[model samples]
Target chain A: MKIQVLFGTESGNAEIAAEDLAESIRNDNQEVEVHDLSSFSIAELQHDSLYVFLCSTYGEGELPNTALPFYADLSVVRPDLSGVRYAMFGLGDTFYKDTYGQGATKLDDKLTELGAQRTGEIGRYDASSWEPVGEGAVVWFAGVLEGVSATR
Target chain B: MDAPLSIAVIGSGPSGCYIAQSLRKALPQSEITIYDRLASPFGLVRYGVAADHQSTKSIQAQFSRLFERENVRFAGNIEVGRDISLAQLRSTHHIVVLAAGLSADRAMEVPGEGLPEVYRAGRLTRLFNAHPLEPTGVPTFGKSVAIIGGGNVSIDVLRLLIKQPEDFANSDIDDAMLAEYGQAPVSRVDLICRSTIANAPSDPVMLAELGRIRGVRFSCSDPIEVAEDAPRTALARAKAIGELLEVDPGPETRAEVVLHFGWAPVSINGDGHVRDVELRSVNDDRTNQRLGADSVVTAIGFDFDGGDWHGLGALKADSETGVLDQGLYRTGWIKRGSRGTIAENRSCAKTVADEIIADLDSLEQQSKPGYAGLPEEVRALAVDYAAWKRVDCAEKEAASEARTRRKFPSHEQMVAIAHNKLVESSAAQRGN
Candidate 1:
């Protein structure tokens, strides 16, 4: 199955995380492509590929600069994603308790509301943790991949 | 048609890197070189952000890619005004942008500020981050420390001093310095701010971290008012401070932190080292409290050192456009004074890049040699990106099991490592 690792970042952590996950997928002999959500079109959400959204929350739970246009297009166009299976991981600091990981949550909600099915549990990598994001992201995606395969 | 754009950016800090990133996107064929006096890149990320905040420092991975871009180079260990004159750089490059950030800490100017126990926030922070310029002496903070500013920097000091050794797992904090300071642990911290809680400039998220520090008791003299109509940030700050104030350290309490609002330092009292601090309430005419302190650290702010090597220190940029003069530019903390976060610098850089692009679009083409045009001796002094990478690898290789990397605390050591002289020096030491 083709996997799309889409990332939106303000300070580039999410992008780095997406790249790490893509490399991990490749190491497992799987095909993957990395996409920056800034230029990604809402209409590109197809049922054939599994989408993994890696997004970091900017100030007060807002989408990162690169993800803003994508999220806006998704909200306005409200594309039907009936057969789309997606996983999500948010990069955030737990110190921001109220708005922590809300960027990924917002995208997850929008996709679910538009009839897309989510696979496995939503993953999170806390910036406050001592664990490095690259390592933590790869570990999170392993579970996500297992769940996707089991569902298949 | 036009000569390929040649740009030289002074300082490899966030602002400089962001400017280079934007300019690379807009003018991919341009010659761009970022210079720093230190033999390293990512100025504050490598040295200013608290060592424990490794997540924030991870932004270097993005900036690191910028140094590897085609036609872009990093000229480390090169000081613009000292190694190569501003006039020389101008003659060599089509444009130069000064992002050399403010260097001097704004002095408290109170009597006894020069006491041995008194330190500036910038120096202390740099010291912990193992900045080569900062003295590596383990600062003595005997039991009580009084921080004289309300910014995030002050909180950073408080966190560093209060955190246990275990809290720094995988962090690149200077272990030797931390161990020496840990010998005489600071048990009390008095955070003094001239403004009210609502007006303190520290982010609420930063202040909120205080509540999470294990085994610390917090108290506030000023009432934390979360007014219904207060601004969201102010309200959040008040709530955080209020929550911290309610924390009960219990029987196993490790330390105590007291927050003082609406108070200004009158004097630091000590003969040689700090003994106590004198403070006055802004509302009252009478001189008020004297808290016994082992040391006093000021985090008021920063200002440029009087030597304006960048030649744009006059703040003469067109306020609306950010253009100083033809072929001259400024950005980052140096451009707008010492303020703003790294994220803000990215936007500021984009704006300046836009300005530079528009300005260059109108100018006539002229052949300009960028880094290659510099004198052989000056260029020889630079530790290029690859050499600096060697230093980086050496630092990581030298780390203990707990730390991510052990930074060279002196310029000599880093230079030696970068130039592959460490092996020879170690062999010499062994012979001795």
Candidate 2:
């Protein structure tokens, strides 16, 4: 399966996670492409392939600076992701008073709203606990693969 | 081997958290302790971000998870210079990450900067964030408010002054701050930009947000000259111009807050108090404008406040590259002047981290110690891992009870809570 990994990071953590995930997938003989969400256009979401979004929510549940324009575009109009299978891993803190992980949750909801099938349970990683890195991420990805395989 | 190298990270802000997380991922065996002058982690994320923008603040939850790592510890409410010294840190931790951010605002260089009403946007932001220094009383907005500068800071201040609770209630602003903001008689917020709209650093999101304001009108005209005698008129001219010129100042627009672009402040006209601000056109074309407002906020920018390490020869920074004398590492606003969004800081930080890692192999061969050995002063203040976690929990509980996000009103509160929690946990462990 051709897997495309897209990530948005404010301080590079999400990018690092995305890269690590892509590397792990590649090691398993799966073709993986990783792109920064800032560089990735909304149109690319329509590609006929499996997708994984590893995005970091920034100031006040907003998208990272690089992913803002794309987010803005998505917010206004829904894009078709009919056959695309996807999973979202959002990096955020729940400590903030407002809606915590609101940004990532918004994206996940929007993607699903546009008819994309969620391949796995949405992974919401809290940096406060540091439990979501390494093995945690690996296990989440494994579950996604299993789901995708079953669906196929 | 050898009890995994101990690393202490100072500041616990975004940069500090990122560094700690990266180090943990790179070397899981190493022990990491994140420290901050405040009792809570995530420095600016807790305070600097505007209250209405709760979405941005949500990122702090991610940092909290990083602290929960097996080998990572969070220490809050411990001032590095005061509680501990740089020399002390070197004795304990193998590596010390100084992610301390800029603590001071860049001066406007105008005479009336010391006036009561003239505030720094950074300071104002901290106040609204309920930072330790936030004044107790409502700020006197008078009839007009002139905010100098065209950056994100300026935009935020303008938003706060104009939008009121009806605009911000849905956002994450704290109750106390929102109540105070709602009571303030801030009819107009004039955003002063030294350059054209194209050159201004104000975010487009802010501009779009500003456009939505009902009672506030944004003007982009040259400020009127302030005469020695007619101090009030000079300030009122922008308002007057806004009322007459704006064909459609939007539906909620009433009080004119003229946004003056292309003017550099020359002086503040007053001896003891701020009465008027004398401004000159940037071209030195002799065109003058005097802005009369009760309060003036210089939102120019922020600058790094190098702590006790300022005069240390060991921390000497190269004039050109901004690298430290040891050359093992460098950093964000301190290394490359304050500018750029968080996204930009990522690339800069990555470059610095990469350079430090690249030299690690060569330095190990030469028997030179990496940043593992911090100065003694920093190590002294390092709180135990469990203590920091308690402080983090206390802040969360406090924020939740207040129906607001996490906020530690004072540094002392954080320290006390953390210390108590440490004691409680120790007692429980002993009983077990």
Candidate 3:
């Protein structure tokens, strides 16, 4: 399946993580494309067969600078995502108790509200830990592949 | 097989740590040495960030994790230009990354700057954070503190000065500084912005925080009025005066601090000691005001100290080439103008690093002895990567024991620790 990995990163951490995951996915014999959220558009996202969203929550649980406008449009415009299957990984520090991963959670909730199916549970990565649990990404990809195979 | 490439990074600040981390993961075999001017790492996080912002300071934990890698070494108290020269770095390592951040603050250049009470926000923040400069002594917060500027730094100072002990306890403020702040009889603080409230550079979070101050009242409408003997007032002064007028002081009570906006200091009235500040209205609008305060702090911003790098010739370069000098790179406030939040620097650094890496493969195609002209000073030093790691461990242990973040007290301490480690290693080598 063609997989699109889009990332919104502050300090380029989530972007690096997305690139690593994309490399892993491609190594598994699946086609993968990675794009920075700043350069990627909502309209372009419609073409992806499997969507993976990796984003970091910035100040006060706000979206990263590059993803702010896209997130704003996604929420108010209510774009249809009927054919989309996606999963989100939120990068944040647990120290911020009040607005923990609010950026990614909002996007995930919005996509689901727009009728998109969440392939698996959202992955929450505490940047304070500084380790990516690839198990979550692997399982989500497997689920997406299984769905595609069943449909075929 | 060829030997793995070795890289030396000067200044173990955020950019340096990030560069080392990226290099370690991308090129695992490559050896990395992170050299800092101080014994401790995490430059701005340890020095510049306000003590009250513990949530932001916690990001250093991630950096500490990156340094834990076997291939990475931390060299504390190694001043690049002084202890090690550019020529020496080129000879010892295949590549050298300069991630040293800006060290000095920009000046307001107004007439009253030389006044006894005049201070810079950068220095003030550093002093309160228990940075090496903190030992000098905390600044006395007079009856009224007028902070000039509406940026995050100004807001940070305001919050630190005005917030009570309970608010500060939840954060990681240094104990001594906290006590000093508590005893300071400063009651009124005036934040002066050049423009209207809407045009202020303060972030929404800071604005909200300012609004939440229980004992402090904010005035956006009132401006300061200039007395005949007072200095000229800027537009901000007009707004402050309007706000101050609205405030009702109880009988036998006065606002402890008055934040004067709009009036830029034209001259100092007193002889060597600052008696009063002469003010001028901004834009020559004729509306003037004078703040009759004993102390003043110019919170304009920071500028890069380019004097040291002047020998590098055209230190400036196109976005594609990193720095004009080969093997040299600039990032963060040093690369671009001082603007944007901390996260913006990541992209800036990445862009420069990518440019250097792109040229790397091509340069290696026509390879020669990389370090042909070694500087005499760098060649004489017996310091190595392993010795640096020992000093790093010692600093981290000390910080952990103190239940605080890592800190290098002085330049001398850092070098002494590193030198001792080098001697110990030599002794062990002979024994073995």
Candidate 4:
């Protein structure tokens, strides 16, 4: 299966997480490519690859600088994503309380509204927590990968 | 076409890496080599950043890419002054950037500071991060601990000391050291701050995070007063502290963190180790108090010894710009003192890079050997990126199931792992 690791970041944390996920996928002898969400056009949703979105929340739970363009593109274009499957991992600080992980939640909601199928739970990491966002995301995605294989 | 010059950047920290990045973009064909005393790169990001804040440390992934470029290289385990003189590097490279960060801890300058249980925040941070130079042993902070500072670093030390084992899941913290620290549970932590609640330097987010920790009580010496006309930052900070003070730890509370505003450390008093800290009010009231503490950690700041490191009696660089001699330059903490975040270092490096380009571009410059000009023994001692990757992998592979990675705390162990040498045992490698 072709896996696309899409990332949106403010401080490059999401990008690094996406790269780490891609590296892990490759280690498992799977084909994967990583891309910045800012550079990914909404039209590319027509592709049959499984998408894994790793995004971070910026100020007041808003989408990160890089993810904003992609989110806007998806909202306006509203491409048919009936056949698209995705998984989400969000980076946020619980210190923000009200808006924590809202960026990823908004993106996830948008995808589902567009008839896209999401596999596994939407993983969330709190910056205030002791665990690293990347480490937690990797652990969560491992379960998602297992589920994908089982469904296959 | 841009001038193809030889550039050597000392210290592979954020400033050095950013300097290399900016220089690479300006002069694509130029040779760039970043040098560090440790076997690994990402100086402070790897050693000074809190282990739990791996997201912040992930900036290293971007820096690692710079080393993969043919034009830029990393020379680890090489000190410019000790291994090869600054004069030799200047003779070899067109421009030499000194990004060697301030490593020395600024002394508290109070009596009884030389006690055994008193540790500098930098030293403790390094120990927890598993910096190769730090001694291989877990610190014992006993039941009561006193931290001197109101900065984010003081909060980081407090968090490290108080976090439970389960809280450390998936973190790359020194698990063995953490386990040892956990042996003697810290019941109380006093944060002695010279600034009031409104003026405290710690970030509001950090203060709020402390409120969320389970089984901990938080209190402030001075009540937070949020003024309607105050600055937005001050208001936010006051709100965060107010919220922290509202946290009800209840009877189940295992620990308490007290914030003492407008208090300056007069002395750290003890017979042999840290037994108590004496503090005097910074206000005109001039009241003094003695708080009993088993351990005292100071998170004040860091300093650089310009006299010993740089060959010049004192580095006579331009205060605004980092220009010293014609070919010699400086950046990061060495240039601007111990201030600015990692992001600020990026801009500082860019400014220095711009100056270097403008200075060397118009002039007819002679070619010089950059990395090739370093001593053969020094080059041999240096660990390349590939070898460093082996050490990185080994660290991860050796980690327990719950941890992301377990760092080798000694230079010998890291060097052995990097070189694929057969070390008898971890204990033997650490000479314990």
Task: State TM-scores per candidate.
Answer: 0.83, 0.70, 0.74, 0.75
- Ordered by TM-score, highest first, the candidates read 1, 4, 3, 2
Model 3 CAPRI rating:
acceptable
- State the lDDT at A64 in candidate 2: 68
Error of 2 at B112 (Å): 2.4
RMSD value for candidate 1: 4.8
Residue lDDT tens for model 4, B198-309: 7777767777778767788888877677578976557777888888889988678889998888899999998888889999998758679999999999988788655556
Give the Å error, residue A66, model 1: 6.6
RMSD of 4: 7.3
Model 3 residue runs over 4 Å out of place are: A1-5, A13-50, A59-62, A68-80, A92-102, A119-152, B1-4, B21-31, B133-135, B212-214, B221-263, B278-286, B313-321, B361-432
- Lowest lDDT 10-residue stretch of candidate 4 chain B: B423-432
How well is each residue in B95-159 modelled by candidate 3, as lDDT tens digits?
A: 77777776667777777677777778887787666675355566765776667776788878877
Off by over 4 Å in 4: A1-152, B1-3, B69-71, B315-318, B362-364, B424-432
What CAPRI grade goes to candidate 1?
A: acceptable
Strongest candidate by TM-score? 1
